[model samples]
Target: MLKARVITAIFLLIGFLAALFLLSPLGWTLLATVVAMLAAWEWGGLMRLVGIQRIAVALLLGVPCTTLMLAQPEALGLSGSLDKGAALSLAWWFLLPALGFWTLLVPLWLVRRFPLSGTAFGLLTGAVVLLPTWLALVLLRHLGPWALLGIMALVWIADIAAYFTGRAFGRRKLAPQISPGKTWEGAYGAVAGVLIYGLAVYFLSGSALALPLLLLIPTLLVLTAVSIIGDLFESLLKRQAGIKDSSQLLPGHGGILDRIDSLTSTLPLVTLLWLVL
Candidate 1:
């Protein structure tokens, strides 16, 4: 299992890097939309929406995603304006759903462990989580591919730290029912790992979170925890769906949502903060 996972991860990283660096903005946008649509399909499965229901869900998401991208075809370019054009207007729109879902509802759902399976609420939750993350991907890629890459690296770092550290020294449960594999020690390790990465970006890259150095660390820490929220939220969905993985779409990676779960939370929030400041 471990070997399969490692090999899949390596190939995924390679393919991802190639697309990130080589694709034109329009090309990247199309690729991102396809990925989001696949996640939407898996999300529909979790909602127990079958056949036509799943196809409906896919079009429901894809149509709006197409609209958003069409709204700012140029803003996704290196020369596009993020301040005055469609991107800015939609950024404000994106901010509300992402913030509301992550800040108000998700934490409550996590604490309460609400019975959200196959419900309208679960469908709404999937929309809220998936849409803004898609928005973030487009906006960040437009800003610059490097910007997108750096922000994603933060989530990647946190996940890696949590995995290895949890394996080595995990003790107390982070959320026993939703995700038994998680641990408080792993959370701490993720924080430390993101901290190191954040500071490295701050000092070395000089592309820290457009905030004071002291303030950036706290922001990174919050984002780290938020990434965990994203991970656990999907785990909860899979739990309610009574499944071990979202789907066996990626040899060892489970599915699209399984791979990008953390990004679903972290990316939108990070982009919101970036746009705000």
Candidate 2:
């Protein structure tokens, strides 16, 4: 597992750098859409939409919907004058729906006794997971390579901090019912790591951000919290479906959804928050 994880990490790092630096905005958007589609496929399995017909339905609904919602900035009220920096900021703020999924869907799932068993439910869940992340990637490219690098750095810092903190001092579980390994200590570490990363971005970049550190601190906190929830949500879905990982697509990572579960939630929230504040 560790070897698989290392190999996967190396591949992801290389792929991320290439996508961020080398791709045009349209290229990035297309790549993000493809990734989201793969995630949607994993989600379909988790939701028990496994047959060819069900998977086809998911792809049919997901592809066009994601493209329309995430790729077309004009539909989302973004103007042509918006530079990469402004677009990235806006994208960070547009994550409200993804946040709403946790706020609304988790309770609904529990109250309804986790009624996410059907094909329709799976498709709905896939939409919720894929659309925001797709938009985030599209918007990241729109903001230019540096913005993409900055976002990836924040997520990487949080993930690394969480892993170390959880391993060293995770006495209290954060979500024992969903993900037994996660803990509050790890959560705090993740938030701190991202905040430190954001501070570095503030000093290093010439983006003319107002109250940059202040904005980044709260934003990073929110993103981290959202990221944890996203992970747990996927775990819960897998538990309900009686599976271990989302898929075997990424060897150690299980699947693309497993790899990007946190970003799926964080990116959209960051986008939306950037837009509003």
Candidate 3:
């Protein structure tokens, strides 16, 4: 299992890096759309959709992505400038709501242990969870691949730090019902790790982020907490769905959704923040 996971991680990293640095803007958008589509399919599994139904759900989610790419190419940074166009409009119209969902509602849903129910609710929620993330992937990469990579690395650092810290010092549970493996100590470790990473990037990358330390530190802390919320939220869904993993598509890594779960939550907010400030 470990060997499969390592090999898979290596390949995924290589493919992701190639796409990130080498792909054209449209190519990157298409790749992100494909990822969103697959995640939507797994989301169908969580909602109890089967076979063709899952495929349909994937298509349903993917259509809007392709539509935005084709219909409003400028908005997606595919053709023209996104500085004062639909992309800015979308920052408010599309991603603001997504930001609200992640920062406001998801934490409540997590605490209440809300039951995932109703087809309409499920589908709408899936869109809320997905579309903005797809947009974030497109916009953030366009801003700069290394910028996007640095932000993503914050999440990776947090996750790694949390795992080791939890093993070493975990005592009290963070979310015992949703994910028993996580702990408050681990959460602290994640925050610390992210803070260190944020500071390093700020110093090393010079004007890359363009935020002062005061603002940057708070932002990093918030994102780290939200990343944990994202992970916990997915774990809750999988628990309620009575499944071990989202799907078995990624060999030992569970599924695409399993891998990008934190990204779904964090990316939209990062994009929104960049747009705002």
Q: Give me the candidate number with maximum lDDT.
A: 3
Highest TM-score: give the candidate number. 3
TM-score of each: 0.92, 0.83, 0.97
In candidate 1, what are the lDDT values of residues 103-167, reduced to their tens digit?
A: 67888988998866655776677778888888788778765668778888899999999999999
When 1 and 2 are scored with lDDT, the better candidate is 1
- Local accuracy by lDDT, each model: 0.83, 0.70, 0.90
lDDT at 60, model 3: 99
- For residues 195-228, could you state the per-residue lDDT of candidate 2 as single tens digits? 7777776777634223465565666677777677
Q: Decide which is better by TM-score, 1 or 3.
A: 3
- Give lDDT tens digits, candidate 3, residues 188-247: 999999988889878887643568877888888889999999999999999999999999
C-alpha lDDT of residue 231 in model 2 = 71
